[model samples]
Target: MQFTDEDLGAWVARQRWYAGKSHVPRFRILDVQPAPGATRYLLMDDAGAVPALYNVPLALVDAPSEGDAVVSRTADGYLIDAARHAAFAVGMLAEMGVDVGRVTGSRVLSGEQSNTSIVFEEDGHPTIILKLFRTLHHGENPDVTVQRALSDAGSPYVPRFLGSLDAEWPDSGRESGVARGTLGFAQDFLPGVKDGWAVALDAAGERRDFTDAARDLGTALAGVHAALGASLGTVDAGPEQVASTGLTWRRRLATAAAEVPAVADRLSAIDAVYQAALERPWPQLQRIHGDLHLGQVLAVQDGGWRVVDFEGEPLRPMPERAIPDLPPRD
Candidate 1:
């Protein structure tokens, strides 16, 4: 079934991709196109105070495609197809005369939660990974923002950002409005290496050692820290922030304890780690990985780990999700 403006608005509100829930947001169709028998649309809105965009590409596949077609079921919620939702994205970009040649092949990257991403090769030179941002926050995204800064600083570890495609606001050129809303990003697709998380999981699942993987990740984390510091200098970690970190940990632990009950007994053990972190003889301020996990690193063909997706955890607020953050605060 196709979505009318009202239907699309309600449908977007119900989506896990919607991102904002506190207010009944407004949506404007910036562009539209026919996709064979399907309908492609680009939508923009102030999701509460968060300015966001969506490229809603839905196929009228004889009835309606199940919710699972566009969203992947996850432990938290459905993961949106930020990457492969291209029909509408193409329509949106068409306004700017963005040329989309024939598609070669498209594959969804694994280990995604909120956003959807798909990699496509164009004549086999400079493959592009299109990322649709899941959560919308006003202002430029820190992932794109920081990565661009790092790229400008000549860092080669992160993929070279090519450009972004999004919908332009109709009233943007007017005295008081936004010019465009970001829809997706096109970046150089790194080839070959399996994601660090998959490698680690394989090793663990096969009863093999993960020491090498862990060590490599540790080293990559260090390099990422250094590069980030070079790009965005260190800052002081205030006592208030430090105390707040401890309290946040406590609250997280408390919530988990409430859910699992037995975890309450291990609070002391967790506290030991926290206290050690606080007492460690290290710089309290440095630009470090805001969200470092096994999956965020990749083992390259050269055997060194390449850090991927500097976009911090989606669960965190936008302000705290970027690098140049107080190292200890992370």
Candidate 2:
């Protein structure tokens, strides 16, 4: 059943991704496409000054609400706020087509900073993770797009690609005034792995011997870069191109200097580093993790790291994020 605009409005406000909590946002459903029992919505949310689209996937839950809310401590538990829970219980579930007759318990995974993810398990068997995308964008999400590309290319580091759900409308007369289409995704549950950031920070904080781990990471990243380069196409590295690396750093420094008053001195220092990086020359340009930080990787227990979340830096515009010509993350 298609959810009403009232339902969509109430649901989005409570979600962690709804950046505009101060006021009620308006929605415009652009399109709708339905599957066997589920539907995908393309939504336009006007929350204050920011307006964008999101992909939301949901399934119904039955039985009793016997489980405690899943909470994440990484972002200080901000993602699991009350509004988010309400949306999950009502808006999200309302769109799902699953007929879960019995829900034994619900466990929310802690530590995720971006999406409000809930792990639903029944009869002691691990099920799927409901990923509520916090930030919305147009076009295909890189996480989903890249994962499909990698899976098609037979990459092993990524988790198995499970079916996803999105929102869409049949015509202009849909009750949901907002183009409520594909809002979220569902992916296979990857168990027993620590996010790379927590692991790296743990190692850094403890001053433990992490050279081997770092080398392993370096190799894995290199492989991914190589794969991406081959899959797409690699550009030849030139001395001039390498020298321009400092430009990006300079731009970052300028941006930091404008907004952070206390960081003026630090920005100056960073400027010097940029100058140095400029003088050193540029590395070969190839497709790689545009946003490669510790947080982007997951360390599985089976002796390897799994690269997830292909979505680039949120600060960049959507077009720039998809620009195939950009350099890799520093």
Candidate 3:
């Protein structure tokens, strides 16, 4: 089955994970890779101010059932979102070479931003969360690299890395059949754990003292930083690196000022703060979670915390995300 650019653009615009939601995207198919039970398309969007890339994996079925995950109806069959289909989800796990024993069930997790996550459950084996990378990059993703490194370093703060999926493709304007991209990642899932954000909110509502938990969380984060630095190694922030970072800050501020009317009023003050910060001696830049917050963590029953989602800011470019930089912005 095949789809036109217009059809894909319309479907992409309706998806919650799509970055360019305000305008209709002009699509260009970079490559197509066949998965176990689906077809993955590497696409480039030229609609926004900057061109962006994405991965759209689709499953073709002869007919739609009552609970079918159909995205569109084609002449030959119904197009389904593979990430949301149980069979496709299981196939993905097999592709990743994950030995989950006997897979009993699978379901798509909600509240994901840039990628689709499917949770596979089995009786004996540990539950697994398979994250399908929506945005396609040329090489290794920091999420996969960082987690594997930390897990190999014996870090208990992160989930155990199971396996991954990648594809070779022929990219235009480049050497044919040399380009490869990360398709998805699989990791152990901690069941019965609550998100840090929810835990914090509940504690606040109950007027419970969370100072100790906060302190422990801080300690764990520090340990994670130490592990990442030890494994990946770090470099001193040279003058050129500092200058480039400063420029990024300024560009981000300018973009915010244009998009948010309220920011325009304090642009001068923001610029002043940025300049002042730039003048100070920069800290050694190393691999860290590029996007960190309460929500990116989980609280276990034993008063322990597990950090998840090493994928950097979804809107940032892949190359920039892979490079070591300042600590997570939030």
Instruction: Name the best candidate (by TM-score).
Output: 3
- Model 3: per-residue lDDT, tens digit, 49-84? 977788888888888766655667888899877787
Per-residue lDDT tens digits of candidate 1, residues 103-129? 454555665656777676566543666
Candidate 3: which stretches are off by over 4 Å?
1-3, 124-126, 175-178, 257-276, 328-330
How far off is residue 120 in model 2, in Å? 6.5
Q: Of models 2 and 3, which has the larger TM-score?
A: 3
Estimate TM-scores for all models. Answer: 0.67, 0.66, 0.89
Worst 10 residues of 3 by lDDT: 169-178
CA lDDT of each candidate?
0.61, 0.58, 0.83
- Tell me each candidate's RMSD, in Å, in order: 7.5, 7.9, 2.6
Model 3 residue pairs with clashes: none
Ranking by lDDT: 3, 1, 2
Query: Of the candidates shown, which would achieve the greatest lDDT relative to the real structure?
Result: 3
Sorted by TM-score, highest first, which candidate order results? 3, 1, 2
- Comparison by TM-score, 1 against 2, better one: 1
Q: Model 1 clash pairs?
A: 82-116, 83-116
